[model samples]
Target: MNEALVLTWAFLLAFAVLAYVILDGFDLGIGILLPFARDDDDRDIMINSVAPVWDGNETWLILGGGGLFAVFPLAYAIIMPGIYLPALFMLMGLVFRGVAFEFRFKTIRARRYWDWGFIAGSALAAFMQGVILGTIISGIETDGRQFTGGAFSWFSGFSMLTGLSVVIGYALLGAGWLVLKTEGQLQSRMRTLALPALGGTLLAIAAVSAWTPFRHPEVAERWFAWPNIAFLSPVPLLVAGLAALVFYGLTSRRELMPFLASIGLFTLSFIGLGISFFPYVVPESVTIWESAAPSSSLWFMLAGAAVLLPLILAYTAYAYWIFRGKVTKETGYH
Candidate 1:
C-alpha cells in the first residue's frame, strides 16, 4: 500500500465526517429544538431557517459513509455490524424529519403530528450519531475483520452518556444558529436556551475527556505522557477559552460569534478525538494503513474526489450564502 495515498484518503474521509457533523449538526439541532417553539409561527420560522440548506448539508454524510466503504473497506466492514442498528435508526429519524419538513407545511390539523415527528426524528438521529461515536470510541469487538461483539454491544452506559452528550451539543449548536438567525423574542429565547445547552455540552465534553483517558491506556499515554502532554495540553485549554467566548457571546448578545465559537468547540473536540485515535481508524484494533484499500483503488477514488469535493464545497457555500440572514415571517416557507 502507498502510505501517502492511504493517508490522503484518511484525511478526506475525516474531512467529510467533520463537515457532516458541523454542517448537518445545526439543522439537526434545529429539529431537536423545534419542540421548544412557542407557536406554529415560531416553529415555521425555525424550520425555515434551515429549510434551504438542510438537505444539502447531508451530502457530506453520504460522502463520509461512501468514502469509508470504498477507501477503508475493512474498517467499514468491522464498524457496520456494531453500528448498523443505530445507523438504521438515525436514517429513519432523518427520513421522518425530512417528511415532516415537507408535509408539515402542507397540512393544518396534521401539522402538530409532523412537528412532533420532526422533533423525535431530529433527536433520535443526533442521539444515534453519538451512540455510534461512543461505540467506536469504546472499541468494536472485532476478530479479524468480523465483528465478534454481541448485538447489544453498542448499548452501554458510556454509549448512552455519549448519546446524551451529542444531543446536548447539537442543541447548543441549534440555539446558537437561532441566535444568529433570529431577532427579538425568538433570538432572546434561543439565547436563554443556549446557556443551559452550552453548560451541558461543556460538562459532557469534560466528562468524556476524563473518562476516555481512564478507560483507554493508549489515550492516556497520548495525552498525559510528558513531552506529548506538554504539547497537547492546549486542546483542553482552548476548549475552555471557546466555552468562555460562547458564554460571553450569548450574554453580550453577540449573534454570529456564539455560533462560530460553538463550531470551534466542536472542531477542537474533533481534533482531540483524532489525537486519541489517529493511526487506528477502528479504535484499538484496525489501523488506517491496515484497513486501507489497494493503492489503485484509492487513486481511482481520489481522482473522482478531487473533482467532486470542490463542487460539493462550492454548491454548499453557495446555498448558505444565498440563505444568509435572519429568518422572518415574510422570508420563510410558511
Candidate 2:
C-alpha cells in the first residue's frame, strides 16, 4: 500500500466526519429542542431557522459514511457489525426526523404528531450517535479481523452515559443557535436556556474525559505520559477558556460569540478525542494502514473525491450564504 495515499484518505475521511458532526449536529440539536418551544409560533421559528440548510448539512454525513466504506472497508466491516443496532436506530431516527420536517409544514391538524416525531427522532438519533461513540472509545472486541463481541456489547452503562451526554451537549448547541438566530421573547428564553445547557454540556465533557482514560490504559498513557501530557495540557485548558467565553457571551446577551464559542468547545473535544485515538481507525484493533483499500482503488477514489469534495463544499457554503441571518416570522424558509 502507498502509505501517503492511505494517510491522505484517512485524513479526508476524518475531515468528512468532523464536518458532519459540526454541521448536522446543530440542526439535530434544533430538532432535539423542538419540544421546548413555547408554542406553535415558537416552534415554527425554531424549525424555520434550520429548514433551508438542515438537509444540506446531512450531505457531510453521507460523505463520511461513504468515505469510510470506500476507503477503509476493513474498518467498516468490523465496526458496523459491532454497533449495527445503534447505527440502524440512528438511521431510522434521521429518516423520521426528515419526514417530520416535510410533513409538519403540510398539515395543520397533524402538525403536533409530526412535531412529536421530530423531537423523538432527534433525541433518538443523537443518543444513538453518542452510544456509538462510546462503543468506539471503549474499544471493539475483534478476533482475527472479525468482530467477536456479542450483539449487546454496545449497550453498557458507559455508553448510556455518553448517550445522555450527547443529548445535553446537543441541547446546548440548539440553545446557542436559537440565541443567535431569534429575537424577542424566544431569543431571551433561549439565552436563559443556554445557561443550564452550557453547564450540563461542560459537566458531560468532564464526565466523558474522566471515564475515557479508565477504559483503556493506553489512552491514559497517551494523555498522561510525561512529555505527551505537557504537550496536550492545552486542550483541556482551551476547553475551559471556551466554556468561560460561552458563559460570558450568554450573560452579556451577545448572540454570535456564544454560538461560535460553543462550536469551539465541540471542536476542542474532537481534537482531544483524536489525540486519544490516532492511527487506529477501528480503535485498538485496526489501523488506517491496516484497513485501507488497495493503492489503485485509493488513487481512483482520490480522483473522484478531488472533484466531488470541492463541489460538496461549494454548494454547502452557498446554501448557508443564501440562508444567512435571522429567520423571522415574516421571512422564514416556509
Candidate 3:
C-alpha cells in the first residue's frame, strides 16, 4: 500500500505540474507576445484570444503546489528555502500579470501601462520558472533535509540558459497559439515570429543537453546506456518530427497544426525529463520515496485526489471546448 500510494501520488503531482506548465504556458506566451502586436486593436484581440480560459488554466498551478506541499513536504521544505526568492518573485510576477489581464481592457488611460505590466510579468515569471528548473537539474545543495545553498546559488550559467530557454519555449508556444487563433496579417506575423522562436528554443535545448551530462553523471549514464538508449531514442526522434511538422505547418499556413505540434514538442520534452530523472524528485537531493509523506497521510490524499483530479480535468476540458474558436475584434471579453 505504501509503495502504490507513493507512486500514485507522485504521478498525480507530476501530472498536475505538467498540466500547469503547458496550459499556463501558452497564455503567458500570449502575454509575452503582447508588445510585438501591430497596434492597440491587435493587442486587444490577442488578449481576447486567451481571456476566456486563462484564469481556469492557472488552477493546475494551484493543484501542483498544493500536491507538493501535501504529498512531499520534505522536498518542498528544502526546495522552497533554496529557491525562495525566485519562487516568490515568480508569484509576484503572476500577480501583476493577472492584474494586467483584468485591468488592460477596463481603463483606456492606463491600458498602455497594463500592457507593459502584462509583458513584463509574463517574461519575468517564465524566466524565474526556468531558473527553478535549472537549479533542480543542476542539483540543490542540502544538509540532511534542509537547503544549504546560498541566496544566489540558483543563479548560474546553466540556470540562466534554462531561464532563457523557457522564455523562448513559451514564446514559441504563444506564436503557434496566435497562428491558430488569429487571422490575416497577425497570423502571418506570428508565423514569421515562430520560426526564430523555434530555432532559439531548439538551440536552448541543445545547450542544456550538452551541459546536463557534465552537471549530472547519473543522467548521462542513464541516457547513454544501451537498453536505455533504445527506450529513450524515440523522445528525440518524435521531437524532431514535431519540429519539422511545426516548420511545415507554419510555411503552409496551417492553422491548428503549429500549435498542436508545439504541444507535442513540450510533451515529448516533459517525457524525456521524467525519464532522465525518474527516481529523484529534487534531483540528487531527494528520492521520491524518501520524500513521500506518511502512508496514512497519502491514503487520505489519494482518496481526495481521485475525486478532485477528475473534476479538475473535466472542467479544464469543458473550458477549452467552449472557447474553441478564432479570436477577433467581434469576440469581446466579458
Which number leads on TM-score? 1
What lDDT is reached at residue 72 by model 1?
A: 92
List the candidate numbers ranked by lDDT, top first.
1, 2, 3
Residues 1-334, candidate 2: write the lDDT tens digits. Answer: 8998998988898888888888888888888888778999999999999988888888888988888999999999999998999999999999999999899999999999999999999999999999999998888999989999999999999999999988888888888888988999999999888899899999999999999889888999999999999999999999999999999999998999999999999889988888899989888899899999899999999999999999999998898888888888887855
**Candidate 1: regions farther than 4 A off:** none
Least lDDT summed over 10 consecutive residues: which range in candidate 3?
Answer: 1-10
Q: Candidate 3 has which clashing residue pairs, if any?
A: none
Task: Name the lDDT of candidate 3.
Answer: 0.89
Reference-based TM-score of each model: 0.99, 0.98, 0.98
> How many clashing residue pairs are found in candidate 3?
0
Cα RMSD, each candidate: 0.7, 1.0, 1.1
Model 3 lDDT at residue 272: 79
lDDT of residue 330 for candidate 3: 84
CA lDDT scores, all candidates in order: 0.93, 0.91, 0.89
Instruction: Give the best candidate by lDDT.
Output: 1
